[model samples]
Target: MQPMALWKRVLILLVCLWGIAAAMPNLFYAKVEAHNDAVAAIEAAGGTATAEQEAARAEWPDFLPSALVNLGLDLRGGAHLLAEVQVEDVYKSRLDALWPEVRDAMRDLRDQVGAVRRAPSPDGILRVTISNPDGMTAALEAVRALGSSVVTLTGVGQSTLEVTAEGNDIVVQLSEAEKQATDDRTIQQSLEIIRRRVDEVGTREPTIQRQGEDRVLIQVPGIGSASELKALIGTTAKLTFNAVVSRTNDAGADPGPRNLILPSMNEDGVYYIVEATPVVSGEELVDAQPAFDQNNRPAVNFRFDTTGARKFGDYTAANIGAPFAIVLDNEVISAPVIQSHIPGGSGIITGSFSVEESTQLAVLLRAGALPAEMRFLEERTIGPELGADSIDAGRIAALVAMGAVGLFMIASYGLYGTFAVIALMVNMALIFGIMSAIGGTLTLPGIGGIVLTIGMAVDANVLVFERIREELRSQKNPFRAVEIGYERAMSAIVDANVTTMISAATLFILGAGPVRGFAVTLGIGVVTSVFTALLVTRAIIEIWFRISRPKSIVV
Candidate 1:
């Protein structure tokens, strides 16, 4: 009757609609490719699902809510993925960082001794021949940081002196093992990272979780394919720049004395040539997009920060004759010569990469490099068939719960049962709205919580209804009965829902993955149920009274 009341009704409807819209994508495959697949399936199936099948489907929960929000994987088919992040490569990365120091130490030892040659040994040993016994002792001291040991010596007192050194090979081996362990830990850290990224990107109800030591399990409901998920997680995008090995005519010419710069390495026993000095680190790039160059070849367009751009320009200018290497995850992708300066801070990397490869690279870069390099320890795919079955089971459980609650409300209460049903509907709508608002994932447990909340919602309504009947039986006027019912029952409903809310909050705070998902939906349901039962349902009863000014109320 009043403008304010009309607006309240309108607000409730709009919020319910909003929740459904927000959840639609996660509940249904709204992507173009999925649409095409559904269309094809429909055409192949002779234009419709069989009447028996359609009837069975209706008996099950209908996924289409407002023609947008669809059921989650527990009601539809989807894929799951489990993969581990690789950590061995991170150790190699640390080794790469130590190259400058390793090279410098090698040269110092070589000069002090007769000549030092890199030997293929597990301990990273360098064989050195000393001109004298004193020099041999000096060379060993110079290489102390290398963890070397003087293995053999000959002509201790003679003019010609030789000493073989083997450092702490055991320590180095342990270091490699530790690196692997660190990589494993990175996978653990990455679980949160992947979860945040996926959730923010609006992948509804995705379960990104840690599996034993190094593995992660991700289940995305209604996301029926794992191709994108695989591409997102299985990436070892360790990017670095190295100076190209010198191929000048004076190859052996000593790199002129300059304050020790990164690109400079000791000339002796440094086997890997300096490919190129990286001017711009991958860290500077904020975003990457897949694109094709003028040649229509797959490439990634990258943008760098101001600092990166400046450094890149300087390196290209200084190394005009040298080629700079673009290394991705320690593998050399390109060795383009610094023919000219590239100062714009943005450039395309041209390689023989396929469109998919290029896109994958772009995604990895944009997601940012892992704190440490990682390796894929394992990978497995979950078929949609299993997800579909789970969906069916969950739907049946929810239906049974709803049916039981509905029957109990109608049979236990007389005219008041109708009001309780209306409140239950609003409660369901509010739960969906809240989930959509926060993008909470609806797991099977989450479905159970929703169903449980429906019964709880009716319980609140029944409390008020019973209070109304008491007031009416006492010979109170219809309006007075309605007012007294809400007033008396409000305190009880608040006490019950508040205690449940506290428990839900505790669960959410202590839990992870699916447990957290369940907690979120449960907490939201409790709040929404209370509001719908007390406020919306009360409003509906008031509206009914205004329409029919009867001497006696239905209750």
Candidate 2:
């Protein structure tokens, strides 16, 4: 309205554009070189890389930031996994950490409750068969006395009280708040551990988010097989060091065969036993790389931190002839004997490893260690065929919608409609540039939302242009009319966009996956459209009025 503020508006717009570009590099332009490198690596692996990857490799320029807006598996035709961690493993970890107290508590509960009954279910959830439910309350008090923490006490059958761990695997009595705290912690820790594992596998852009309590949603765009992914993440990566039972110690031992340390077991009874306590755990290892053994076989070479190296050297020197097992997720990969003491704190793990298997083992060993053992729950695969169809349909739908909206605006508003069309183009450019800068995935649903946003963006300009016509009818000059129209229509435009933005925000917070993606494009469109219409379009109109300086304002 104030002479279109050309220089000021352009400067502000540039600043906004630059900021978006800095924050997100995915939407506006694709980075070519890194994309090409990814293609080359995959091709070198004898895998079928995508056409886009080939194009990127051939044409990608240098100097783009490493970050890219990665498409979701639904759009890119990749792998999806839903993993549920073993709550029992979580409980066991806690119990093992607090063994002295937990063992004592369970023993005290058994003795105090007396007459313990087995749960009807096959899962072996034990219950106390009390003479009176009220009498069992005293025994519960004794269990609570083992620790001051709250305990959960549930009545199963008439005289049975079901006592179990409140979180993951460890059952303990806790208040509502404590239960919530435990749930929060497990989810948080699991997310971190999963992130570390997934990163090790070298996915382009993987997403690992917590779903409802106790479940995690993992999406890897370029990954093909769900089973391989499940194998990669289902491991809890729990490593323990235990003293080995010697042959002499097994004979009439006071501590019953010197404390038989059982290895971790899979559902099918597959288990591994570490013959000796690990002088240094996987946590101490800083890096792992695939290498070749003396026989040119695939092997994983690992290096430990200073402390780990020192401990390893000391332990190997002390136990020169004994065998130490290389265990993973409770299964032994290999158990090589300490032929001679090596003090470097670096060693190679040689096994029956293929090239891929060697790489995977190196990844796992390098990903630090998992807090607890995990298990696979569910998985799904979306083929490239479906993804291609979605892209084509989405593109056709967007073109049709934009063409229809453009025709309607020009038909209704005549000459003024032409200006509204120009504003629409600017609005679109800004949206795309912003999206590219942010690197958000452009899904089919996201495209639908953007089309809807374009219509809403045009609505604001239409309202202002119509208001200007009304002012001209009231015998005002074109300049005066444009100013008044902008002033009069500003409130309505603000109210409309604000309400829509609030709704979009609400959807974003509550929705999951695709729904959230839809909300994201919708919300971004609203803010950018508002800026283009209220400032950019207004400036263009006012500047035209100043130059023309027409006597009679055409309606």
Kindly report which residue stretches of model 1 are placed more than 4 angstroms away from their true locations once superposed.
Answer: 1-81, 86-88, 99-185, 192-205, 211-213, 221-232, 246-281, 306-311, 370-378
Q: How do all models score by TM-score?
A: 0.70, 0.70
Report residue 98 deviation for candidate 2 (angstroms).
Answer: 4.6
Per-residue lDDT of 35-119 in model 1, one digit per residue for the tens?
A: 4345444565787965544543443233443223334555455556766555544444444444344446656555445544333
Clashes of 1: 20
Supply every candidate's count of residue pairs whose N, Cα or C atoms clash at under 3 angstroms: 20, 23
Encode model 2's per-residue lDDT on 200-281: one tens digit a residue: 6666546688878778888777677787677777765654333344322132334341143343222233333334334567
Q: In candidate 1, where is summed lDDT lowest over 10 consecutive residues? A: 257-266
